[model samples]
Target chain A: MLTYIVEDDPVAAYLAELMIRKEQFCSEVQSYVNGQRAFDSLKEANETGGALPDVILLDLNMPLMDGWDFLDAFDSLAIAKDVCVFVVTSSIRPDDIEKTTHYKHVRGFFSKPIDEKALKRMQHLLEVPNN
Target chain B: MRTPDYLQAELLDLAVADATLFNFLHGTVLDGLWYWDLQAPENGWVNSKLWLTLGHDAQHLPPEPNAWQAALLPADFATMQQVVAAKAADAACHTFSQVLRFHRLDGSEVWMDCRALLLRNEAGTATRLVGALLNITREVEKEAYAVEIANHYSTILSNQSVYIIKTDAAGNYTYVNDLFYERFGYDAQIIGTSSLNSIIEEDRPKCLDVVAQCFVEPEVPHQVILRKPYNNGPVKSNHWEFKGLVDEQGQVTEILCVGYDVTLLTENLQKSQHLLEVTKQQNLRLQNFAYIISHNIRSHSANLTSLAKLLDGNGNADQKAIFLQMLNTSTAKLAETIANLNDIVTINTQGAIAKEPRLLKEEIIKTLDALNVQIRQHQIRVEVDVPADLLVPVVPAYLDSILLNLLSNAVKYRATERPAFIRLYTYQEPGFIVLAVQDNGLGIDLNRNRNKVFGMYKTFHNNDDARGMGLFISKNQVEAMQGRIEIESQTDVGSTFKVFFSTNVDVDLYS
Candidate 1:
């Protein structure tokens, strides 16, 4: 299965890609620098019948087209693929978490450092027990 | 047959009918009557009560219409003659009435209501005249007394040095005098319109409350200061005293309001109140400020500490190098945040920031020189059109920082496909000198982010190099110098930033 990590911070995205590869969580991993690039790639992939990612790791604060706006644009697309979205925001603002995070395709909300809630959900989605 | 007893009795009753008829007219209305021989023209019989009513002795007066006509004013006598001649000329005119005033014996005047009937012969020529004179002096005095009282009250209300208005229970203007019309400069057409509409919107509820209170407790007067909009003038604050006038049933019928302009008196007080309110808002903002600072700085500091622990673990040279780099970035970001916070605190605490006069064009030149390297490297064009002699009083440091922030933003957000240009110009408005910075760059989508454009750390673009502190700080600095910042932006076109310097305020402060 292909996995995509859409984040703005280069270091964070690189770190997440390395960990996903080391863990052998999926066959392929793609990294996107921002939500707009991720959204555009998704739209092009859908139009061209390219491979769709099974899971998307989304970040909230990016320069252009933040995670919330991306979800809105994607939701309007009404893509038939049931790709799961997991929000990974650095800030723990409850008010921010309360909005746009309840999309039917959004599987879970998580803070930075890959917290237990995210890991548990990922394990469940991949059918792997945490070691 | 001609001498029956019943016939003799009927003839006697018929002979006394005129005397009884005259007696009934005199008894019921309690006035007197006169009989006149119009054919003879001098045989006029005057009743004793008519003379007695005027405090005159009937024995001394002659029985002629001219005798009573002599007591009437000349105009009234002429009116009497006209009425008499009209009936004599047209026999179809059977009756006439006139109100006549006569001189009493004691030199006081008495008013009389005189009514007359004319009798005619077969030839339709008037022969005899009969009339009644009623005493109506008391009624005329009562009517005149009422008018005098009304006139005195109206004079008092009109001349008062305050505005006087009367409204019905529903607060609609029933009466607005000349003074009220002139002071507010409203035409007479305002009568019957609502008084509440003239009051400013902000104080409508308060005005309604006071007016309602007066009506609820009619005996007690309510006083309040309300803002009323005047024609072609600044909204005036007026101190009004309202009193509810009640009908006999103790229910309020109307309200009377007296007020005077209190705008000058309350202006300074309202200013201080507004300052206090602003201070309270800033205090609340401090809480949000503290929250943001903790979130940003604490995350950076925590990341550095965690990286150092990881670097100490048995990692390879490559891993260690990455850890060191991450640690460096974390530490620098933390320091930058702290410096930004310091600048914010400085601006937030300014009471009256000291300002010095600087040439507008010269300052723009200095700022453009500082951004020359960026302008050259990006192939961005710069244009400055400020007046050479125009000088503005501002804090030099803030002006430099604001200019640098705006210029850097223009360069940082330039659309790659377009030839980027930044234009700086200045112009003088009525009470301000406005410095506008125009740029053809990646403009903000103001439709979605207008409210948050000046918000702290609100960045709308994909440039991660943006810490989102520049514009917020620029806004703070402009405000600290007793000026304001404004922006007009569109999504794909460009943005214009304007800073308004109040000429009136700055001159008043330093002069």
Candidate 2:
């Protein structure tokens, strides 16, 4: 399975990419500093004949198109159905938790810096087949 | 001068006629007469015609000698008895008279002006007494009616709230009602002796001047401003309307002045002036905030747009990679600025207060750890003298953001000549926790820009990292928590920032 990390903070984003690659959380890892370019790649992957990334780690605080706004626009694109999105944010606000849980495409909410424990948990969940 | 029997009888009749002749010589007055014989007391004759007009009958009256005394009111009985006893003491007395009540057969009473003529023989012994009574009821009723009306007028004058001052033609206060006395803190007995001038000397001169103008011009009311000292040691102002009183001879004898208090009007005017000043300052702040948002956001957005265009156009592989990297960095920076602006917007739109508890020591330690690399690079000395138990009652995110901004600014703007020395301390002041953040950095010229340091987008130093949003956001967060931020700084020396947080937070007072 392929994994993607989308975050605006270069330091935090690279850290997330390193954690996933080291833990073998997925077969391959790709990093994007913003949501728009990452979303364009996901759309192109759907049109071509290849398996989509099994998991996408989306950072909420970003430029032009934030995570929430990107998710709203991505739902209309109808790229793939099996892929899961995880909202990763530094904000520990209660309102953010309440908001991300309502989205059907979102699997979980995680705080930064994404540690090895969360990467292993994701690896285990992604290995399980959907009913 | 006794003549023959027939002549003597005629002379006696003439003498009696002359004595009673004054009755027919009437004037335009309400006086009637009566007569009584002491030897034959039942033969008393009251003013029969006057009593008849008051619905009385003379024939059916009591036959007792002093039956008329029943007509006297119970209150006047004792006085009438005294007068009668004095008259009957000496029978040889020539004159006996008393103003007594005459009860007619119809059970009606009338006041009578009575006078008596005594008839005495050669031994100076009284044989009979002839008395006369005049009806003076009309004059008594008129006088009593006048007094009742005056009493009603006084009742109205005393109950009124406004100050009623009646002055003679000379503008001297003849009557100051009870309201005037109580309101001006004067004695009720000061009605006539002391004038309005004595009590309110400051306002009196102007009031008298206005009255003089009214006197000069009849029917024209003079309005004057009367400012006088109250018991509270403040000069209370009033608006007085002076209505002059003039006699039929066209001479102004007194002034009827009515004054109303206008202190509230003056206070409202001052409040409106203060509101105008505050509104002007807010307008200026809004203008500066808009300018900051436009200039800062546009700068990053333009850089990103141009770099993207350069990468998309013709370039070598290395140059393209470099342009692409530059574009991504610029876009990320733009996103960060937008995020900060969104935070500001969120804080501004909230209609209620926040309920976020932040541990002061935890937040400070986290911010220092985040800037640990910079600390090592600068070889800076960090002295955190805050009490370990101190916890600020604030929203967690905002508290972190405020302290982070202040600490970063201190480290980033250090003086070039000296090694950076930053100190953080907290102590209890009179009403708040005084949190001091001191840095031996390039101190600000506070005198030149004292009031504008916390203002939106105001930067003094030429540091590239000073976008000016940090202090502004910090200030907003501090004010939102009902705390105040003050700064003491001098150029080349150091800067000390004191944040005062009230200790009255009920959720966690000091835990």
Candidate 3:
């Protein structure tokens, strides 16, 4: 399994990457500082016929294209395989939670600092087909 | 065959009997009768009816010209003489007539119409003047009452403050009272001209339709505003009401327009509407601010809780060290976010602050000096074109924060391909003094982020230090000093931020 973490804070991104690696939830793990970088990488992969990540953890607040903008841009792309997008944001705001329903690819909404219990749940979601 | 003495005696008797019959005829029907012999020394012979008309006994009245003149009012005596002179000058002028007032013994006056005819002798020379006098008191009284009513209405129309105008069936002004002319700055020359032409071009069609309706229904009134042409002066808005004036046959023959100036009232209403709009905008911003605050605080608390959960679980030394570092960083970020929120809350709750007149140039220079290191790092070319004494009302600390944030933003967001350039200037606009900060930098995409540009933690750029709190804090500070900030930007071109300070701010003594 391949996973992508899109977050602004380097510390948060590093922690999430370390947790994903420690749990061995995915065969490959990549981290980006903002939504724009992740979005560009995804677009480049699509153009080059490279393998796309199975799971993408998106953060709401970031410099240069935010998570919402990324979702808007990503929704327009034509891809054969479905990629599960989990909204991993520090915001517990009902509005942010409600916004996730707008994207069909978004699978779950999780709060910050992905603990052991959250990782287990995410791992379970990754194993489940079409979840 | 009779003797001369006997015939003379018979002639005297016949003359006395004729005189008795003539006096009786004159006394019965006529109020008075006068016979003036031009050749005689005495003025004339007047009957007892003359004394009766004067409200006096016949015994008391001396049948002399001087006595009759005393009974006539002094002003009428001269007019009576003129009548007699004119008649005497022209023999062909057979009749004389005049209406004169005569004073009575009871201290009251009676109006009389005297008519006289010139009686000529056989040689065609006038010898005696015979006239009849009739009392016309009741007729004169009725005529005087009619004049009083006419004068009363004329005074009311002329003195009334409201504009009053009358137009003919063709919509031409037939009459405009003094108040109408004075209010609209029109003159008598406007009469016989189309009154509808005075209405503004935009309102002309509607006014004409109303006038047409008035002609159809004479009982109903039509209303409209007529713009008064101002010669390089403030506009005067007036509200006018027009009604049809119908004749006895119920045909609309005229239009009466009455109106008053409503300029002040209209201005006040517009001012109130503007205030209402401003209040609504402020309320919406406050609601958005509350949401942002709760979202940010909750995000921070969630981060802390997750970090604590991770620490509680077992981990390797290397992993634990990394987690500790991340936890410290998260805590610091949370503190910084709280501090920014506190600052906004303080500004919002404090309301308007004390302001003083400070030179805009001085404030801009101070801001530039503080950001000198950043300016040098970016090699920005700064240009300031501001008047030396152009003062703006602001709180000193708020002015510094606003200028510093704007100047730093220009440098921070500058494009790397070209040398950054910043321009600061000050100018006066109606009701405000504006300080504009312009920059050639990485401009914002206003179409996508117009609503979120000044929102807390809303960053559009990829810069490492783009915390997105600068503009939010700056806006709050500006508002505290009774000022506002506006932005115009185009992607990759440039951005201009204009800060407006109210010109009517109350100055602080201790600047």
lDDT for B285 (candidate 1): 66
Off by over 4 Å in 2: A1-131, B1-13, B17-47, B52-133, B152-160, B164-181, B184-229, B232-237, B240-258, B264-338, B346-403, B423-436, B444-452, B455-467, B478-493, B498-511
- Residue lDDT tens for model 2, B127-164: 55555556766777798999999998888777765778
Best by lDDT: 3
Say which prediction, candidate 1 or candidate 3, comes out ahead on TM-score. Answer: 3
Q: lDDT per residue, candidate 3, B141-231, as tens digits?
A: 9999999999998888887667788899899999898887776677899999998667667767877887888898786778876666543
Which run of 10 residues does model 3 chain B get worst, by summed lDDT?
B502-511
On a 0 to 1 DockQ scale, where is model 1? Answer: 0.16
Best first by DockQ, ranked: 3, 1, 2
Q: After superposition, how far is residue B424 of candidate 1 from its true place, in Å?
A: 2.5
Number of colliding residue pairs in each model: 4, 10, 0
Off by over 4 Å in 1: A15-28, A101-104, A116-118, A121-131, B1-243, B247-269, B280-288, B305-321, B371-382, B408-421, B429-431, B441-469, B489-493, B504-511
Interface RMSD, one decimal, each candidate: 2.9, 14.9, 2.5
Q: Which number leads on TM-score? A: 3
Go through the candidates in order and give each one's C-alpha lDDT: 0.79, 0.70, 0.81
lDDT of 2: 0.70
TM-score of chain A of 2: 0.89
